[model samples]
Target chain A: MNWDYLLSLFMGGLTRGSIYALIALGYTMVYGIITLINFAHGEIYMIGAFTALIAIGVLTLAGWNGTAILLIAAVAAVVYAAAYGWTLERIAYRPLRHAPRLSALISAIGMSLFLQNYVRMAQTANFLPFPNLIPEFAFLKPVAHIVRSSELVIYAVTALVMLLLTLLVRFTRMGKAMRATAQDRDMAMLSGVDVDRVISLTFVIGSAIAATGGVLIASHIGQINFYIGFLAGIKAFVAAVLGGIGSLPGAVLGGLVLGWTESFFTGYVSSDYEDVFAFLFLVGILIFRPSGLLGRKQMEKV
Target chain B: MKAEFKKSLLAALWFMFLTFPITVVRVNTIERTVAWRWERLIWIGAATFILSFIWRRLLHRKQTGRREVSAGEVRPPSRWKQMAADPRLKGLALSAAALCFLVIPLLFSWNKTILVTNALIYVVIALGLNIVVGLAGQLVLGYVAFFAVGAYSYALLNYHFAVGFWAALPMGAALAAAFGLLLGFPVLRLRGDYLAIVTLGFGEIIRIVLENWNALSFGPSGIDNIPPPGFFGLALTLRQTHIAIYYLMVALTLLTILVVHRLQHSRIGRSWEALREDETAAQAMGIDTTGAKLSAFALGACWAGMAGVVFAAKQKFINPGNFTIWESILVLCIVVLGGMGSIAGVVLAALVLVILPEALRVFADYRWLLFGALLVLMMVFRPGGLVNARRRAYAFEPSAPEKSERP
Candidate 1:
């Protein structure tokens, strides 16, 4: 049994899962509150990566060093992504709050398309090379074959983000408001919670996390284009659904499960049908457990 | 008005900030070059400034219109609605539209004929999708998979066994229906959003399989040189063939419209409508919700299959690229923008969406961007779509005042 090969695949899955979890967090959080799938969430991630690239390019031209450029670019990505998310909710989604569920979904889809084209038109359609910002660490030379230094960073950052998010959701006054809104929006509004503000904040927080993931993944993958968000968004959404969409832990677990499944399948089986396998897994999960693994079974109110 | 101007100004400024990174900075990492596009910033600022004012005005008007309605103000019927209600005008409009359809193709060049023919094909496909989404209320994101199935079935069968178009049409449709049932059966139990994702997944699976499974699908380069439908085995020239396809599409489109109209009035159609409104209520009313949903999928898939076969014949080639999720979205946009469940609306939308792009080739780059914006704006401002399907009205007359009964 090739233990080393298995270990490498495991690490690969972990890295991939971390990225998925970051994006899925946004989808789950937004869906938890509004019950509207923010289709443009993926586009926010794309925008983040593009923003980071632009920042890096400008900083490099200004003769900045590596670490400072990375830091500023990441910050720029997060801020811009959060802004885009907040604005998107206001423009495309807010007016449709009183409308039918399908209307919001369509609008979300439209926003996604619009954003994708906006990037394509503003930038280039060809793949832009994402610079690898994370340097190789000399300390883990022996186990370097199993896991790259960047993968370790991704895991650590994802863990830290999750911990921070959990703390925010559990302890803060705003967190309490968000919880109330998610539980029952009308009740929350009546109880003096600003529902609109809470919803916008959720989008902001989600988009910020997704941007972090976008920046990290783009660096890892070494290339990005206008269309990366669509597939990634779909996969992340799938992971969120697998985890039982409204549940944060469920999203993380789902991401890990999906990432592992994809990595192992591609590692062992033919890589040609990797996407097919992921999609089939989604279908199977949806068919068997519609509410998801961690999602509570919602009662149909009479 | 002053407040509105201030808001628009704020919006314009916000847009300028939002667009700074993408619009202002162009980075080519491979060449290590940074191109600063300052003009784009100006363009964004200008566009947003003007658009914001228009947007605010429309929103204000919409709000006022809603307020008037809520306040019990009796608004007169719109001119279009009144014209539609008048039999004389309706007949005149119908005949004029028919005359245009008949005369325009003959006057058009081969490219124009092909474009119109494609539009006609979409009209059929859109009507099919209307059955599932508009009528049955199931959002199948992978609707294009069935279309692909039909196309591939025809393509492969013709390539292997020399099966002609006439022989392949029914076979293609049946195969597509089978595939629809295959997808619909498992997903029947899921809710709307979940169903959408699963269908999307199913679509990707189909595409990936087609692209990878070289032994079966010819692997992405696609099947080509597939002959157009034979007119008694006569070798028609390219222009003649295109004209034939156009006429064929016209005939098929008419058939689809007639069938869809009939279905909309049928018992099954009512069940679909009921299912769409509220599944639980529909089920409580003894409508087999499952059956209705499944039938919608099968029937919708059947039409897509027919259209797919025709699409293959028209193009004389079949590839995975022709049946992407975007194609499904395009058909969906027609069903939606035209007004769900409205046969005439679907036809009109299909014509406009398909033909408008070809007609306005200069705005090709901004097409998808505008489409996305249009979808959002439509949802925000006009959720009922361009033409709301007229609801059935029945008048209840009180024959006489029952004074004795009241006493």
Candidate 2:
């Protein structure tokens, strides 16, 4: 094996997986609470990228540079995405909450369609170049041999975010409320938890995290497009399912595994068949172990 | 009632205000310039008029506080159905309806005939989908893949082996049915949203294969110059051919309705209904859930295949692009908006959904946007559908309740 080539591929996969993990976190969190799938979550990510791209463009034009531009862009994307997520819940979901499961799903599908077309109409169809924030890794030639500085930055940021999330969910009162709500909505309500507020906050948090992922990915890939969300959403959904939907750490693990599989499969096999591999993996897991690798077996209510 | 009216009106106005930016401001991507679509004002006007009319007509009826019940036992007929279902005039109305169906196409201009033909084609597909989505309660987002399979089977057979349309029709449908069984076997164990996403993935895979396999599917540019079906070995001119095909589509639609309606009352159909209402309980009740699900998938695919064969014959061409995810969404909308399991509802939905956007060519750009909004709004307001299916009580007439109860 060419160690250098494998090392680079692994690095690339890790970067990609970090973003997938971010996106999958949103899906898994929402599914944990309501089990709605949130089909429009991908569009939230896309909107994040767009919002970040515009922020960066404006900031750079106004003479902002380097880390400052990235900071502002990241904040802008997360805020915009959180707002979008909250509105989505309020409009597309809240009314249909008591309706049939199929109806809410159909409504979600409609929301997905509307958002896709809305972005397609609002933005150019073609991919727009994203501003590159990372400096040339000329200074890191000694320590970083195979991986670039940008890749390291991605890893560090992802690790920091994950740590922050773990701390929040483990220690914070609001996080406990979210957890209580996710466990049982009616019980949580009975216990005086603001279930509605918890759900809304979950959406806001998930969208913000996904937006951070989206901005980072846009910067890494060097371009953004309207339709990227659909496929990426599907793949990340597969990741969430792979790890055990509703399990946060499981989502992260699944994302990494999915990313590795894609990288290795593309290196050895046909890149065209990579998506097929992800879905096939999903089917294989679901057939043999429906609860996923980490998910607890849930009993169906009579 | 007055407060309720005011609340609903205020809600509508709020909704109107929220959507105003989207309605009036449209970005022209090609020019990279933003412009106002002032034409949306006309739509706003029309919408307010319709809303006011509905408020008056429907709310006024509600205010009367009338039961209009036949007996206290039977399920109350919706106001529209009650008006249409007079016992003395039932036979006369049935005959009139049949007469209208028979003569309507003949009265139609050529363009309208084409539109009707398209609607009939969707009607058949939607009815097929109704079996799976409505009766079985399985959301198959990839339903169009079966349609594509049938179309391609007919086209490939004709292109490769000189098979005629008549011979290929049943063969195409059988092939699609087999494919359905193939898909059903693996997916039978899954349910609900999991089943939905997996099927969606399968559908995408199928499309990608169809698009990528150049040697087999002609690589998405599509098969062209497919021969239309012959009427009893008669070779007619183009105009005559279109008319003949329209009639053929009509015949096929009637045949589908007959089959689906018959099956809806059959033992298997009851099994499907049982399963749909509650799969675990139905299985506990000795219904073969697997068999019911597989049958629903196969039968639904069978009709879609028939529609596909006709589609290939009518258009005289076929492509992977023609069988897109959007087509699946379109057919699902028809079944849903028409009321899930109602035949008449499906027909009406097919007509309105298929013909309305075409008629409103000025708002063609907003077609899908409106459709998306419609799906959300319908789910919120009328999840049961415009003409939701009502369970028939006559099926239990043998052991009817001794006393009628009023709600």
The TM-score measured for candidate 2 stands at 0.88
> Interface RMSD of candidate 2?
3.7
lDDT for each residue of candidate 1 in A27-123, tens digit (9 for 90 to 100): 9999999998999999999999999999999899888977889999999999999999999999999988887777888889889989999999999
Model 2 chain B: weakest 10-residue lDDT segment is B62-71
Off by over 4 Å in 1: B233-235, B396-407
lDDT of each: 0.90, 0.82
Q: DockQ for all models, in order?
A: 0.82, 0.37
Give TM-scores of the second chain, every candidate: 0.94, 0.82
On a 0 to 1 TM-score scale, where does candidate 1 land against the true structure?
A: 0.97
Estimate, for each residue in A117-155, the C-alpha lDDT of model 2 and write its tens digit: 776765567888886798768777864756777777777
